[model samples]
Target: MMRLSVATLSGLPGDIDRPRYDRAGIGTGVVHLGIGAFHRAHQAVFFEHALNAGDLRWGVTGASLRSPAVHEALAPQDGLYSVVTRDGAAERVQVVGAVRDVLVAPRDPAALVARLAARDTHIVTLTVTEKGYASSAADSAAGYLAAALAERRSTGVDPFTAISCDNLSDNGGRLKQAVLAAARQSDPALADWIEHQVAFPSSMVDRIVPATDEDDIARLAGRIGVEDRAMVKTEPFRQWVIEDRFSGPRPDLAAAGVQLTADVAPWEEAKLRLLNGSHSAIAYLGGLAGIDFVHEVIALPAARAFVAALMDETAATLTPPPGLDVPAYRAALLARFANPALQHRTRQIAMDGSQKLPQRLLAPIIARLDRGLAAPALTLAVAAWMAWTGGRNDLGAAHAVEDPLASVVADALGKATAPEDRVAALLSLSQIFPVRLAGDQSFRQALIDDLALLQEQGARAAFARFTGR
Candidate 1:
């Protein structure tokens, strides 16, 4: 079988939307870090639209910071991959050619640095997730960015905009902080130059991109009549809201249906607290209930009600900016979650609870607690995560707890039998929970009670009680 590449693209079925632009003429202008499935299905789709609209400079050179898997998959195909969007039984496949190259930063950081230093590369985007920030400034994205910015500054080339497509709150500001911190470690002058010259624009990206396994590959092969190892599966609903702050020329993303806004905070808060918080809750509880996909999780009466109630509690802490409809967004999220074709796995979303909890669940939880309001639904999700980290489901099957702090979480749970004792011990870890929030007697008691309930009755019963159904 022919693989999906530039040569084979022309033979693809007409219904499968291959790139309309001339791939041979497209030049790399955007350097993306973390060439994960989410990047391929979401941002790369928009860049393809940019290319199709005849902006040849929007081609991407994606860098996989830790894994060579993406490079190995896409490089042989000329960075060509399919974005398959699922809505019910219907699927739309588009071959995105905007990504011209994939670089493994670990194998050759110098190559990635060279691409970053290139004068035509006016924008750099990241979807490296929350845990990627943990490495020291030298090896992390911050370090690489600092090195690239220094080269650009020395060579008298213009600085590029650094956009963070990660879900963390104020990620743009946070990236700037990390980059400057790394830069200052070597040369204060370089840090100063970055502070003034570079623009770290925050962005809010929303799309449920399921990790493509062998099954998805086979399914896509059956649909497109080709082998695309780098293909990604996603939901039809996608969004990207970027702060309208850039150092120089940028891809006409707005032309491709992006929201280039002045203040990305409101949009960020809405998605993080409502959609993401609900996702975390469902992933943990559904995983415990032995539900495979997100739609199946939402199908359970108890789980559906719990998700609605949880979103309501989280939404209470938000002050959405004008023109943003909170109710509509919440309703849409439930419908999106119930898209049966998406097959978004609960175990997949359940990964990295420690890294994701702060912005997704904890901040809203903290907001409600500080306002003298009970965060019952919010605390229930945290309790689910604690239960998930225990490594065994109600079905008596063991699953890996894939978190950067798995050891620390294990040590925190060490030899503790009682739910209260376990809850108090885990809460004391100030890395995930705030110092004051950890010590708060009311918050501590709530988590203790929720954990006790999960232990006593199991996930479904606990969710029903949490939602008062």
Candidate 2:
């Protein structure tokens, strides 16, 4: 058992027997906002592999706005961590050394502003999740962008690019609005500068990086023969699509399986609607049925059929983006969701239901309804969400609901005359559902009916009825 610095452990995987590349030479070029399991397993791993294969100047500097755990764990070891990739056959272990530093969000607003103003910091990326943005535009309010813009206006330092790795539609544009709005509040001149200098690039990031469990840590230690404070496990598949908007020198990530293009809207829409939407369906429905793991739900016959049907409906409405094959892409997504080794828990995916429902479920429902197609399955999923949010599941386990309006939601559910009214009240929150969707009578009733069914028949029977199988 050797005690190695995080930096040293990062270089160990490649240096086990034969050296891959000059691990010590990699430099940090990107700053990531959320240092969560997904980023560690997906983006960090990509950068690590690229660095080992002779690419440099693309190391990641992980940061967080609230969590001190990431900073505390990685800072002691020099911003390095281990990633374990698991599938059915074999587990590939790697140490990622590409993270050069980790920063906590500025406790002092001025200092946080100054950090972003740094000239050498080329790309500012975020995995702060959907809710982290505090977005309000059919999404969160983009609070981070507002803060950054306010800081930039006062400081006169320019950021190169604002990359959003969250699962949102037009994430870059959404973030830009928040930043520009914040800038406009203080100084119009700063808003102009941001409009001209800052590049808010949209991206589609995918990976099923589950939270680290004890067995995962033990396996990492056993395989690598070292102590890794920060270890993340994920499924084998990973994809990153970015709009090529950079204010400074950027990495040639295109050489490492990343797609760079002028427009990432179509790709973003496809991923959000297909993969993420399917995930939301499984998470809410499965969690309500007392299923704990995502793979376990997908393994069930009825749940798998429901998911496949949803994907089929989604695929019908969406054409694949350029350079993508729809059928193959979907087949792969289904396979990824079914990976038993990953054991992605339903509750983990179920978090942030209020923020996630719009993008992952409601948006697709709107799209389908616009085309005059039935989105009954999606509606049922929404019903399950309302049930789950009411703070009780089939097992009587209290759901650790995390929405900002949790108390309001709980109180509303308590006083509502029936399931339909509960659905209506939740939708009317405006903070969760948009005014347009909230006003749709047909949509509201569909949700009510499905929720009533869920309460009466239970999740399994309700799902069986919806699928008619």
Task: Kindly give the stretch of ten consecutive residues in candidate 1 with the minimal lDDT sum.
Answer: 131-140
In model 1, how large is the Cα lDDT of residue 374? 87
Tens-digit per-residue lDDT, 229-306, candidate 2:
788888778899999888677766787788898889889888988888889888888898899888888888888778
Cα lDDT, model 1, residue 53: 91
Instruction: Estimate the overall C-alpha local distance difference test score of candidate 1.
Output: 0.90
Model 1 C-alpha lDDT per residue in residues 163-276, reported as the tens digit of each score: 999989999999999999889999999999999889999999999988788999998998888999999998888899999999999878888989989999999999998998
TM-score of 2: 0.90
* Cα-based RMSD of candidate 2: 3.3
The whole-model lDDT of each prediction reads 0.90, 0.75
